[model samples]
Target chain A: MNLTIKATKNNTFDAVVVGSGMTGGFAAKELTERGLKVLMIERGREIKHIEGYDTAMKQPWEIEHRGKTTNVSAEERWANSRFWGLGSEEVVNHLTNDKENPYIEKRPFDWIRAYHTGGKSMHWGRQSYRWNKQDFEANAKEGIGIDWPIRYEDLEPWYAHVEKFVGVSGQKEGWDVLPDGHFLPPMPMFAPEVHFKKMMTEKLSRPVTIGRIANLTQPQKVHTDLGRASCQYRSKCARGCPYGGYYSSLSGAIPAAMQTKRLSILHDSIVSEIIYDEQKKRAIGVRVIDQHTHAVTEFFAKIIFLNAGSINTAALMLNSKSNRFQNGFGNDSDQVGRNLMDHQLGSGAMASIDGFEDDYVYGQRPNALYIPRFRNWGNDKQTAYLRGFGYQGGASREGWESGVNADGFGADFKKSLTKPGPWSIRIGGFGEILPNPNNRIYLDSEKKDKWGIPMIVTDAAFVENDWAMRKDIIASAVEMLDTAGFKNVTSYDRPTHMGLGIHDMGTARMGRDPKTSVLNAYNQVHDCKNVFVTDGAAMASSSCVNPSITYMALTARAVDYAVKALKKRES
Target chain B: MLGGAFSAPTLMAMNHWEQATSPTIEGAAFSLSDTHRKIVAEIAEMIIPRTDTPGAKDAGVPAFIEMMLKDCYAQSEHLSFTEGLASMEQVKFLELNEAERRGVLKYLEQQTKEKMKAMPKGTPFWRLMKELTLLGYFTSEAGIKASFDYVQIPGKLENIKLKPNQKAYAY
Candidate 1:
């Protein structure tokens, strides 16, 4: 197919967001509401609110394969690695197929993602947390990496702004490390979790709280206005929530942006590169390859926001080399694909609680109890590692699958399974992996994906800091469970490689100097002011908590800055 | 219960003769032989015998396992499981009684556990049998309501103390 430059020199939008995901959605909404005509391009198919979540209302028995993975599809398509549930087939079709978009892994990495209008936001864990002052000051304090150009104070207001709009359900304990957020009513804790929390506080002098999730326990005006209801506690948010209970791009940002009537969205438009103009010294627009027809096209915009995730966005920038910028766009520092980071996880344990057989819960709780980071805090800075980790876990009665070996048949088995099984709890850690320049991702120009874009080659691996933290992560969980008077407490530490956490960040890190980083404080490329990267790519450090919430806040703040800068003719 | 709607004799007939010998049903291959199918059906019934409710055969667990194995299990897993069944036949070839056959199965269970400890990889034959047995039994109406009480649309959360005679949930 022939390429057509629809917008010659006049047809330029106020802003162009290159992804309709967690960050892109917020960017579109914030930019459009600021009275700017924003054009959002998504690499995947269009998924509308409520109507697109066909399997959200399905019961346990209503699915085929009963949540089991099949070999036929798994072998045929490499994208099956991202496919989890029974009803995730349609969404799986939109994800980057492993066979078509291959990446060489020095170590095994589970890069789970779904590329759609809302991107992985539709399937996010929804656990939102604010990055504390310490998290912002980590780089400068430790002298590990480059200092973040902006501190927590600059982004705090934006966090509150996004939090209120997203309707986070969290208890305000006033912790300095994690900080409080603009929250809706917190989800009630399970009795076991409450019991454990009390015990842990009394014994260890550490606090355990219900996870600061983005699920609306109590519907606020913002949620109600957005046509979202309180969570029905279905725990099936991964399939996409029809009630719009959880804060996804589809449930939150996209609809708000659509309300502005200034935003236009084009899905299945895989952005190949941001076209850089030599004379203007700014991004003219972007070239997109239509996923279905393989048709190449270009759309013009005065400003461009690349929120196409961490690796992909960085790869695009690396692929956008021109006569002026020979190495790559904004590669003066050569840090465009350096300092890659991901949370190290799956190193924890579960134990059986003999009691709570009769007392069963109402619904599958979407959120888990969280144990905030206790290491490197206050007088307890003595650790085998420098950074810290947090735990997310829950207690529940065992299902029928738990009693496989029990001797019974017809009547006895039926009667036994009608009630709840023995109570059990699991605690898993999400530890921070410090941004190491050695841990990086680069564009493999030799290989091209199905979209004809250069494949991202990852060469990241967890180091001693991660290994040291994981030891305590497992031991602490076992200690808590044992202290709670729980019997049969056992600990486990699964072997994990980097990127398995699926929280990839910091490839195009923000720094005070252009010589040290790709993006500046406001997520604008220091060398090229017209281009911005508000995704995980701009993260200076990988905080212990999930990073998507932070990305949303950053995107909103950046869009506000970008729109104002454009008005001021700064570009 | 849905399982009780089918009589014991009817289930036994279905177990022994009905659709067991058919190599192809509607152009789809039905792999297991009649005798092999009966063994699986009877073995599953013995594991969760008919006591004051419908048996494994009544719950259609035997059929469920057969279909699940054919569709879901890898070729190596299917071979291992069939090999396990053949070993059981080897015990019977030594002119062992029904009780003796059960004793051999008990021994096999212990051996399987030891093997699992040594190698924590893909699902083994005994593990597959156990998994299928649990899945089929729990999902069955008699298994769900009788063995473990189920509440469809449990609207509210209640924290009630367990009675001495309270049964667990099937699922």
Candidate 2:
């Protein structure tokens, strides 16, 4: 069925947000509160907040495979091979099924994504950290790629704005690389972690802070007003938190946007392209295909925001080719699909600590300890690489799985396993992959998905710089453990593949020059004033920290600019 | 090209071949007869030995291993396991008469440490037997409560240092 709705003179809304995930949710909430009639389009099925997480409350024994992947479930694994979360088998429908819609990986790139109403915001690790001043000014000073048109100062207010609403729990140590944020009370460190932190700070003269996460260690007014409660400390967050303990688009942004009553969300509407009017020289509307009926429809808006994630947003722009912009929409500079980047991880060390057998953690802590970036900053330059990486790790006592080799059958083995096993510490580094033009994603017209849209061909890979950093990531971790006098210190570097970090960014980068970038300082398309791409695609550089919090701040800032531009047009 | 090479039917046939050739314990050995398969399954049960908690058989461990060997294990793993099973049978025959299989198993337990270290990590029969035996035994109601302290809903965060008297968690 083909459905067409003609836009009346007054039918156009103040804004149209293309996704309902981390950035899109923030966009909707920010714009709606600012009095914009925001229409949010989500490609996945609608899910009600607590009710949607079917397996969230289930115990380990309750699952059929006991969290193990079965043959039938293994077939669905390819769809979300890019993502890293448990219960993925039961929640396969929320992600893009690779069998139905496969993307070509010229080099093995795991483009893990969840396309549902909440997008990746539902599955995000929730480790929220602010990008220090160095992160914003690095590209400009180092003369790699383009400078971030907006600096830390420009985003500081917005960061404060979003952090208060999001309820980030972290202690303020006033570190230069990691700035302080308006935070709820920090979750106390486990005993082993406290020991490690003391050693790192005193011995290495380095700061080791508890993970600055978007989890509520203490309930604040914003969360309480929204009818959300504190974390039950279950640590089963990726399965989806019914308690609203962790921040997700479903629990936080969407509900807040809905409360404004000016925001409308439409699910299962796969947006094909932004309808750019050549005569008006602005994005007038968007064309979408109904996922269920395969019916084509059109919705008009004065302003269009593309928050369909990095690859999807870039593909949409490339697919939206017209006579005026023949190569692709907003492709005048030909930079729409270049400079794709993601953090390279899967390189770290795990060692057994012989002592501390008597110590065991009380509950499963949802967050890990973070070692902020100490290398290649403030006169501490490395001969090998320019940018640096940070470590996220923790120590935990072994459980029943530790008794795999131990001898015994009935009562003896049972009695032995009641206490915790030896304490072991493991740390993994999230190193920045520089914005090289060679690392890119392109539209493969030869291959089409189930939606009939051309498949995204990813050709990105880690270069020598990333490999060089991996060496330090392993060596430094071992050195720290050895210096701390932990016995049996061993380091490991697991072979890492691209896209494993799941923090893909920098495809449609923001820059001052239209010739060098697709989006400008305000996240607006350099060529099209009315179009904005506020998701990871607009990132100029991939910082070592988790990118979700930055995405939220950028989205809030972009919507503020877009609303003002819309008002100026009206006046 | 890779997809074309391993069509669904071909993959399934390969899986069945691997399963049919895999080695088994004295109680459970690979043979053409269904009765032989049943005997092997029973022997697997004896190795784990059912008690208050569900044993290897009760946890469907033997069946799970059989299915895994057929579907997941490589051909080399199947051959190695089969060889191990044949050796076990030879040892049992030499050690005692038909009624002395349990006695032979008891002797094998004494030599388990050296024998297990000699076996490779990926051998199908031994690996599956070991994994399922542990999984089935531990996840059983008796295994969880009696063997280890099971905490279904640990409502609060404590992060305590374990005392000498503290019981181990069943996680």
Candidate 3:
């Protein structure tokens, strides 16, 4: 078979955004909206907005496995196979197959990834929350890693800008710890959750509120105009919503970018390296390998945005070895892949409630009740831990799946199964992991993945601070459940591996000093000002919250700064 | 208002099923003899006996159980199942009278309780058999759609009080 050598003109665009996930989608939208012709590059195959959603409307009987994980899948998705419902027969497609997209793990880092047009945005939990002023000032106050260049006040307007377009469904509780956001009507809570909230407020002096999800409870004209609708409450969100019910790159930002006609998407183009010009001292373009053809192509742009997730973004920059950056592009400080962190989890409590037999719910609610971070804050500063943790969980009547363990069968068993079992509530705590420079990811120069790209070797692990936080996390959770009058309360502190939380952050952190960090305040590379990285890689600290909303906010904020810089240079 | 005809999870399940099994149909690999299948079917039927609703056999649960055991269960679980079955009365268990069959099952149930005390992981044959039977029966179309209530879409989520004799909606 003769493989013909193919080379074309340096594909030019005003801007190039790599990896069309949460941040990339926002970067494309913001850049294109600013009259810049942007080219969005995605390594995965293209999945058209609502039309590509295949499993959004399946019935109970229609499911073959009925949420059972198979032996084949267990062996294949070895790292993430334990993620309970994540292995459900439907949501499997959204996750990266561990066999194909392999990464070396010195320690057990559950590097879960979703490579597609929409990326993991199609399967995000959509738990949106704003970081308080305290979160930005924590590192500097505690003398941990480098301090964040920007504060909460700088990102507040950008958070609103992203929220208005994304249709955030949350209640505004004017707490200084977790800032309020522009919100649609909050999703109604379960009756048991309401009772638990009251109990938490009375006894624990804690605020328990509905999860600030990104799903639209009430679709504004902006969402509807993009062919998206309000939530249908099917709770099969991980399978991808056909209704465009939730905020995803496909249903939200990508379509908005395409509508402008200035945004062009190139799928199945795996970016190999950022092309840096030695004379210019700036990134001129990027070289990509065709996922199917194995042919290489170069695409040039005035500016480049690396939104290829945390680990991959760091790996790409580290792999881009140039004459000027022999160690790696943007590796002047040798901090390209240092300071890797994920939220420390796998600790919490569960209990069986006595009542709520008649107060049961019908549909699968797509959100959970969130108990915001209380420890290590004003009036509640804890010496046990430096940062804090938050809880995300729900209450429900045990369904037929619970019958897998119970005794009985025959007519009596069938009759008993017709009604619900004991009402049970479970909550898991997500704690902040301190950014340790030693906990880092470096590219394995020898081992290559299926794409011929160097496999990323993760040496990151949770430190003593993370373990200390987990102790408090379990204690606080047990206290709350016990105080709420829940019977048979049990607490658990399971072994949590890094990257299992899927909130990977702080590989190329943002800081004031160019010598300390790779990216500046505006997410621009200090060495090459034309390139910006607005994903989790820019995070200075792993705040105890889902970081997708923050990524959207930062991308929007960075685009404003980048576009203004480009304009100033032209003038 | 949940008026959509399609369900995302089911469609994804169907797609996954197609991809995983490929040309082979689900439950094709019974991994059990005809005699073994018959005994397994009878045991499953006895566990979920026919009353107002159809039994496990009628719902085609035996094949599902065999498939699940073969494909989903671990090596230790498989060993326990095969060993447990070998220990049972092998003289045409399915051919026995209903009274004798019930007596044998009752004896096995008692044996399981005694074995559970000594067995560390307690891969008690009865428990595994019962668990698989319930999972296979309840998830089947005959069990959920025919006997139980199944709403394709509830339109909007709401909490409702159920009257006496009302069946719980199958999710």
- After best superposition, candidate 3 residue A483: deviation in angstroms? 0.7
Q: Clashing residue pairs, candidate 2?
A: A362-B159, A418-B167, A418-B168, A419-B167, A419-B168, B23-B82, B27-B40, B27-B43, B28-B40
Of models 2 and 3, which has the larger DockQ? 3
DockQ of each: 0.29, 0.27, 0.39
lDDT of 1 at A500: 68
* Ordered list by lDDT, greatest first: 3, 1, 2
lDDT of 1 by residue, A1-571 (tens): 0122243434467788999888999998899899988888888778778887866665444444445545554554443353243223434443555665567765555566567878888887899999999999988989988898988899999999999999898999998988998888877777777888999999888889989999888888878998998887656677788788899889999899888888888887888988998888888999888888988878888889999999888888889989877888888898888898999888888888766555656656778899989988877884589979899998887777765765433445545655567788999999999988888878776777777777777888888998889999999889889998888888988776777677989989999888899888899999899899999999999879899889988998998888888888854
Model 2, stretches more than 4 Å misplaced? A1-12, A82-94, A405-411, B1-123, B140-142
Please give the lDDT score at residue A461 for candidate 2. 89
Per-residue lDDT for A339-376 in model 2, tens only? 88999888777777776666676667789999999989
lDDT of each: 0.77, 0.76, 0.83
Model 2, span B96-137: residue lDDT tens: 343344443333343455556787654434344455556555
Using DockQ as the measure, what is the rank order of every candidate, best first? 3, 1, 2
Please name the candidate that would achieve the greatest TM-score relative to the true structure. Answer: 3
Candidate No. with top DockQ: 3
Candidate 3 stretches greater than 4 Å from native: A1-10, B1-30, B90-122
> TM-score ranking from best to worst?
3, 1, 2
